[model samples]
Target: MSTDTSSEQRIQLRLGSEAATEELARKLASALDEGCVVGLSGRLGAGKTVFCRGLAEGRGVDPREVSSPSFVYLQSYEGDSGPFHHADLYRLGSMDDAAIEEAIDGTGLQHVLGAAGLAAVEWWEFYRGPVPQKLVTVEIAVENPEYRSIELKFAGQGLQRALDAVS
Candidate 1:
């Protein structure tokens, strides 16, 4: 495991394999408190859903039950701490500001954004503006077919503590 803390409120990790990526997700899950939001940014096939599975596993949910919410938009499951909400906005392509706001309102994303539980949003760039202020941003870069570089950023005390613990 490798960690870097050079950037302000950021942690970068070099994951050698899928297992390593999942392990890092599990570690982050262990440190997250209620009402935490994890924004995931990455291209297709970057293991975003796999990382979410690890997160669900760490939160005492069945990892196998965690899947990408690409078509449905969001999926909710009972976690050890509380509710775990997962959202994928990849399918909502090219939306105007009004459409985005309407989608946020119609899907109850606004509620999830502020809810007292853990939430992970894939393709978070689509709705970045409404995400909670205290956010943990995870950006995954594909170094190879099986390798990934993940960058995490946050300023909340809970997330900072998680970073410190994992580091």
Candidate 2:
């Protein structure tokens, strides 16, 4: 993996395969602490769920148990380190801010945000609510069928450790 030094709190990685993507995510997961929120932004089929699966495996949960919570909106798993909350906001696409907040509340996503565990939200661009203090935004760009470019922006204090771990 390669890292870009454009920003201290930001790092870019080029993943050549699905396993590489998952491995990078697993490294980040190991460095994350409780109450951390990871927002994932990528086009459909960009491997957001795959990264989450790696996060689950890193946290000592069965990777097989990780899946996209598109219909249910939110799914929680018990991990060895702590809880893992996964949310998909694709269904709330283009909603107004107020409606998005309401949907977040209605779907129990509000509870997961900044909660006591590692939270990974897919299609996080749709949410406009209050962002947690411990937030990491990951934008994955699909370069080809088997390659992806991922940029991670760490917004929380002391998040450099996570970035360092990924590198």
Candidate 3:
């Protein structure tokens, strides 16, 4: 996997295989704090799950327990700074008002923000845009047989600190 510099200054990481992506995720997990919403974008086989594995591990979660919750739609891991919520919004049946209200409300945004240091959302189109202004977005793109590109963009304070940690 290879990378290219983006005009937006987003750090692009090329992950060459699932393991590599997972490692990158782990690195990212270590830099997280409360109230962080990580927006993930990628296609199937884009290493989203592998990346998340690293994230869980970085958060001090047992990597053995990490799995894509595409079926259950959401999974929680505790052991890191705080609970880590891995949410897969791909299966939301509807994008209407009620569906979102149900999913986000029941999940309790405040509770999540307060308790979950990092919230990683896979297939983030489900967000319906207008993510919190403080969100940090990461876009993944496959570059080659073993390479995946990770681009990070931020919208709040402490971005440089996060970048320094990631770098």
Candidate 4:
């Protein structure tokens, strides 16, 4: 697990519906611009992608374009705000040194952090390597359509806006 919680700030949220989950996504996306990365983790059927749909909608992109990149690896969506990079690292296993290098050096995933308005990584905790130092990691735990828990962890900051949105 590459999730270094030492410097990260976390907030827990209770979602009453799908809209609530998306609302949280939108609020977080609104706070991010260039040089930002967001990580997401949860169980199967945890509404991770569904939350991404909300984030894409919040960023003014077609929500349908926010599907998981498990197959393609990376999915980019452009909107009036900017580009949204949705990446699924679940299948890739550990992000080796080369992968981490890509994540920071513009030639790889890090390019998304430097350029995209929002970079949402799913199954992020599963990746064994350095996560983007400054990131907003969202963990979704769902019980049903109207009952869910969402935890927002800022890699090195607080998420007041996101908390206010879901509260």
89-114: candidate 3 lDDT, tens digit per residue: 77653568677757766655434542
Q: Pick the candidate with the highest lDDT.
A: 2
Record all residue pairs in model 4 with backbone atoms less than 3 Å apart, i.e. clashing: 103-110
What are the per-residue Cα lDDT tens digits for candidate 1 across 44-115?
999899889888877878888988887788899997777888888886667887787777677777788758
lDDT of 2 by residue, 1-167 (tens): 43432344777889999999899889999898888888999999998999999888878889899899999999999989999999999988968778888888898888878888899999989987887888888999999999999999888665766878886
Q: What is the TM-score of each candidate against the true structure?
A: 0.90, 0.92, 0.80, 0.77
Ranking by lDDT: 2, 1, 4, 3
Scanning candidate 3 in windows of ten residues, the lowest lDDT window is 1-10
Candidate 2: pairs in clash = none
Poorly placed runs, candidate 1 (over 4 Å): 1-8
Give candidate 1's whole-model lDDT. Answer: 0.80
Please write out the lDDT profile of model 4 over residues 1-167, one tens digit for every residue: 23343465568878888777887787777766465777789987788888888888878898876777777667888877988888877765656756644543432565665464777778877544455656777888877756888888765434444434444
Judging by lDDT, tell me the better candidate of 1 and 3: 1
Best by TM-score: 2
Clashes of 3: 4
